[model samples]
Target: MISTRKKLLAASIAALLSQAGMNSLQAQEVIDEMVVTTVRMSEPLLVETDPRKPRQPLPAHDGADFLKTIPGFSVIRKGGADGDPVFRGMAGSRLSLQVDGESVLGGCGHRMDPPTAYIFPEAFESIQVIKGPQSVQHGPGNAAGVVKFERNRTRVTEPTVAIHTSALGASFGRHDEVLDASYKTPEFTVRAIGTNAAQNNYKDGDGTEVHSNYQRWSTQLSAAWTPTDTQFYEITAGRSDGEAAYADRGMDGSLFEREHYGFKGSIDNVSTLVSNIEFQYYYQYIDHVMDNYSLRTRPAGVTERAMNPDRETRGGKFAVTLQPFAGLTWVMGMDAQGNKHSDRSSMNMAMTDYRNLLRKRDAEFSQTGAFTEVSWDYNTTQTLSAGVRADRWSAKDHRSMVMLTHMMTLPNPTTGMKRDDTLTSAFVRLESQLGDMPGTVYVGVGHNERFPDYWELISKESAATTSAFNSTDPEKLTQLDAGYIYNRGNLRGSFSVFYNEIKDYILIDSAFRKPAAMMGMTRVATIARNVDARSWGAEADFTYGFADNWRAELTLASVRGENKTDNRTLAQLPPLEARLGVHYDNQTWSFGTLLRAIGSQDRVDIGRGNIAGQDFSATNSANVLSINAGWKPAARWMVTAGVDNALDKTYAEHISRAGTDVAGYTQIARVNEPGRTLWMKAQFTF
Candidate 1:
């Protein structure tokens, strides 16, 4: 009877396929648009935009800066650059970030260098964002969402040379330059890119200087060979280095160096059943150094200290897409990655040198995953999509001792321990077109089980154990997402909402204190613990073209989280925010203004948060206004200028890090945003 039922189901599917016309699968070409102010949602649960376009309030120097322009995104600012990105109040490993299909990890134990630090936004052609865990084609442990920085591949029919370059000058001694050059023929192509950005200390609205400054540079080279229109192979190499001063910590990053190498290839039209196959392999290394003397002056009676940490990662992926019949598609893939972390430090830089010491390996991690996704367009008005993925995660602890203070140390309880977990994730979604109103609505539910990352396991201790390596439990998340999009005559808009229930959620507590006898002193100790949590959020944006050359846009985002176990507000969550913009554009010039408002956040769980930092106190509401103008002087040549913080309002974001006392700077409650800044940019193409 089971076999007969299976046969009948197969017959019904075959009949449905017969009714739908069969055609060869082909790639769709997408044209990149220049987004000036705000990036609107192009579709339900997704956003695609060109990274090269110049936007108001100064162009982005890194990935986090660019992502903040979109709704439902915020940054945990540490200094002038290298801020961590937060989406929908979730941060750290929950948000999966990939650069050209490769995973990169930071080396800083305190998160001075996030994965987005090494990313130069203008070097990439496009940025794609997938909200919620609605798909599993990427790697595992993406309980929040996924962000991808991708480059476009173009087949050259004839010999060609193209160059796109830009330069910028801004207040506070800020300057930036970028160059992208490519040479292509029918058989092969070569491309090179370079970027430089630097800024000095900036003052707040009160004209008080903050200890924030940075300088960064990067270079990349790539070569691609194409044998046919549908087949291509590419190899890429890059390096980046920088230094930054922070106002939120005792130490500043003196060296942030990164090295990358990758290889990728793809083939299409392999057979009737298979449409395409793709593969990629990548290697990344990060070497970081932090000190109190390099970027700032040592305080009186304070010994000079420095630390060096590094991480090495190797990963690869292989995927294949198959079209078994008309209106049916399947994508299957496997990905694997491994990373090792090591560190060396000098308590007194003048007495002992860290460079001569051998680094000690602390933790190592590895993960292998397999995923399959299917999409079936059963009819013209409706479609169904679903995906399933399984991952095997393993971790090893190499620490032999744990330090409670500068002079106190004890044997590590979880030394030489190993843990493994096999987790599963899946999601299903259905979409339907609203009759003939040029609108679409969809709903989805996803379940993701996430293993603890290195920071969560090795950087902090468990509630009962000296080490969290073997005690931290994996996080399980079940989320429901729904959205609607409409595009008609003169107005376009989109709204997306999500609700999540997380079990065994890893929560960091900075207020935990160990017994004075155990620590040899009385002090707070950061620890990780599991708890139940729930969060819900919504993001909406609308744009209307009122005149031939005038348009207005409004965007709103808000999220609320609760610790169900403790019955308290979740820590480090961003408050409600809104942005309003008006723009006028014609063939020769364009002008725009942006108004941003942030609601006051009274709910707080002070001294508790994630690996980045804990919340300090409740935040007050604030508002800021900015304006920009652009002109086209000649063909392929353009110029733009803008003034940010026009009113010079002294304010700090709700998610900003607390300010620390520096030797030569005034200490505030939190790191303040830049005030009354002016910038100009020039771009040209050849």
Candidate 2:
């Protein structure tokens, strides 16, 4: 039956492509499709191919799952899912993720959500990835990088509605479903989206059933009122819930819930010399529960092993845009947020006996800032752009917990402290046309300042070394960014280089006495001090269209990290990576193949060894291959099929489930990448 289906689909695609007159072509590579544009910049830019959106349907899993297609981008391979994004050797808090305009801090001290899991990628219209410290408007501590997911209001001239649905059946009982729709009219517009997905525990290509089963769902409804041409109003509300199994951590995320509400209005087409003015307010609440035996039952007598944490945030921003001259624009905004976090644990899943271990921990952070960008167009040959921003931010942290009528001594000068931070950043870019090649030559430079978050400042521990919490400070980072872009009618590419230095680099030293003192943990009595360090890397992306129906994309990247104190390789720096892909697309059919290669890395920091490092010297690399084909059976409908990891490669990623201690052998324990797998999908638009 499967063979028949494949043949039918292939024939349909070929027919469509042939009818579209796309038959004659040379061999070319296929790349992911992603368009990147920021609110601060006038033009749009594309991240590397890997950093771009995958060409295939997103797994409908989580935010991170949608990002794996880009080159130089890899995740710590745990078991089934929740693989965190690791970019050029940086992971964890080093990389920051924002949804809409808010941050969803993960509950696992080890970071389960990694921000990616908390977002529904299909719900957003665009995603922007900014490498290095080029922009500080999204909050501080982006020494590694920043990812922003955004959804823009949809506008259409006529009344219409659209719906899309797809499903997948694979080995290990994996299945998924998605439903999204939008309605538009002259006076009002409405949109709604929902999804349901589950997997009954998957087995490695070796046929080992990983206890990685999971189920998740989300729903959103939004409405906008544009009664007139000069003004508009919108209201949006959404809810998300899910749970995933965890093999690497002691606790599995048994319950995850998110609630979001927002309201905004804008004044436009005005005669007050104001280009645009907008007012907005947003509120979100997250409730997370993690337990050791929730998904996979634990042994008897295991009394207290779960963390129930709930976080709430309320914030609002008011922004204004002005265009005083023909080629200049300025955007200024002020925003403030208040948040509270509380945590409590118990022995059983049911609430039989409760303890007053935690009442409610409170924290507040606020920011006020102004930004402006000026651009000048010198005829059609040259253009220049410059921008700068300054901000004042303040935050407070406090914890008052009394357990069993016993008062635990808050570590260190537990007395809270406060500081006022002022940050300034700027950037410059110039572009000019190149002869008759239809290409543009460009150069850009930027700098930014960031402040430490409440968690990074106080959470501390040294599992390998004995370090007391006497001295620890916020991190300060500075980066130098440079890049050039070139484009022709059929070929395009860009290269970027970055150098970032930090003072008080957070180093994890487990060898010290009372190790477990190098981390961001509050309940545990440990210390994570700050040292100096440096990180630098280079990345390049290119795409070439050799023929009308064929094209290819190539990407290459590398990163190096050093601990200034001891001058050693930073643990878990991503290994060198390269990606090559080719795709052929015609009017009726499309086909593509992608090849990814990873280099061997042996850098080690025993004390800071994450899951994948315990056995391997942080060095394991392999080649992965994937192929796909799509056909248009008729107008408004399409069918697609593909195979992932065609070779069933058995390689362990530095942060994958392949790295573990299973049958007692000193196994590298890297979770096996999905073996040879096949999938088919069909879509119809109305």
Candidate 3:
């Protein structure tokens, strides 16, 4: 009975695939540095995005179109893949997503799958962003910040074996493929990654026919161990599945299974107030399936439905980093998380099975945390930082009623009850170096205390006997962030700003409307109270590389929200955007072009929205144009190409979602975005 967390995950994957081999070696120079990094030079509001160098003509199948080209990000299209990402004006679990560091929950309470939908960003290696709520180590409510996706640990000086492959094609019957492999000697190392992608049904810009199609696949495994040279260990496992089709729900995901496990360890030097030590443990699982005639075409008697939901989350963490002297540094940590959810269903077409139905668990949650941080280097251009955190949240509700149909029910309002909280967070930052011309600046302040999820505590409000998971209360946030970065010679740039204030804020009132004779239609339910809100934002980036092969770039973003408890205008924000680019290179080719512009948001209430959608009525403003080219021609090959949305514009993305007017359409339609395409990608390495 290998229990006990499966015997510590099989002794941490046997200490990360122990093999213990040691000898000086060198294999083709780490296989020519494993190529993949074509222009990455931006940082301020912390911009990373390096999914093995992919960014050109947006076909980013997931992770919200690869975080919408960075800069305050935006995405909420629901068609070809699970699009959903919005930052600055925050959304969902208040941002904070993780992948190499756990937290991967998604069993569709209407969100097909978030957590970057089981990520597949060119087999990950970079993807980081931490904007607001400054930093809190990595757990607990982060108040719109953090998005990690890492898989790195390759620093070999001998014995190496590496391989990377990529292929992609586009223009409506899109296709993609990827594989990554690694092996090393001198302690331990192993890596693996795989992916498959697909697409179909795309036509817009006056050609009609939306309703996107999709297919996906994934696999992963990683191992690391050093046993010496300062100690280190790691183990990872992964799995992924596919499904798609959704012009905005009435079911259509057809199943997407996933599972992952991780174990981490580290130690370096370790002495004098302790210097460097880290730990982690993780687990994630999800099995989803939603049906409306398996992907499309329904209605011939209708009575055919299906549902199979699942979710599980687990976590752990431990950290230490102290430098008793020299510029000072300290970090301490402890983290914990837990999650559970379950479901099963079948319908009138009589069971063709959801395993004959019998699985109901409805929510359970837990959280724990403690933290401390400090960094000081008051010399060399000044720097200072601070941090603090504390958390203890809990939840439980095992459903027993509240069905709302199938013969009307209503009681479960958090049946069996259980709710708890005790939160706290903090941050502080300051830095300077502006006077030296190389430019640099920083300022930060953050505080977060959010507690309320699982759709604002038990499916968006209503149902109290003191429970909808306990009458609200716990939102508070205060933010102020600032940034600036500039590089001299040949010019480069960055700028950032933010301001937020939210107290109690937990909005989403949809204005009731549930009884249509006990629900035959008329539906509209959103509930979740608490008000007072405010948001503000700004961003900018610029680049130029006069001659020597030329270059140009510019980006800007904006956000604004308000609803100081109902003065209106704070439901699904994100508008005013811009992007521009141009480039040229030498030594075997390179070229680029980009242009994007947007602005137009009416900000209404309409059925309300925020689990990633809602607010429409201001539409107009749109533009697009793209171009790319690259070629290495030798040295393990490389190729690139593009042509995206080049005027095939048919926009629609004000935080989408809505439109189950199926074939005859008209539920306000809207779910376009994806038309002019023409892609090409190829990569290889030995």
Q: Looking at model 2, which ten-residue stretch has the lowest summed lDDT? A: 35-44
Candidate 2 lDDT over residue span 396-493, tens digit each: 54543223112333333432545567766666667666444334555556655555444444344333222122244545666666665554345556
What are the Cα lDDT values of the candidates? Answer: 0.87, 0.61, 0.74
> Alpha carbon lDDT of residue 563, candidate 2?
77
What ranking of all candidate models by TM-score puts the best one first?
A: 1, 2, 3
The residue ranges of model 1 lying beyond 4 angstroms of the native Cα positions read 1-35, 518-522
Which model scores highest in TM-score?
1
TM-score to true structure, per model = 0.94, 0.83, 0.33
TM-score of predicted structure 2: 0.83
Q: 1-686, model 1: which lDDT tens digit per residue? A: 99999979967844543332122211010111133667777776888878888876564488888888889988898889888999998888999899999988899988998889999999998999988888898888889899899998999899999899999999999999999999999899999999999999988888889888999999999999999998989999999999999999999999999999999999998899999999999999999999999999999988889989999999999999999998989999999999999999888988999998999998899999999999999999888999999999999999898766656677899999999999999999998886634568889999999999888999888877678888899999999999987655456678899999999989999898776664577667888899999999999987766666666778999999999999999999999999998877664687788999999998899999998867999999999999888888786888888899899999888999999999978898999888899999899987
For model 3 the TM-score comes to 0.33
Candidate 3, residue 172: lDDT = 83
Best by lDDT: 1
lDDT of 3 by residue, 612-647 (tens): 566645666787777777777897887877777777
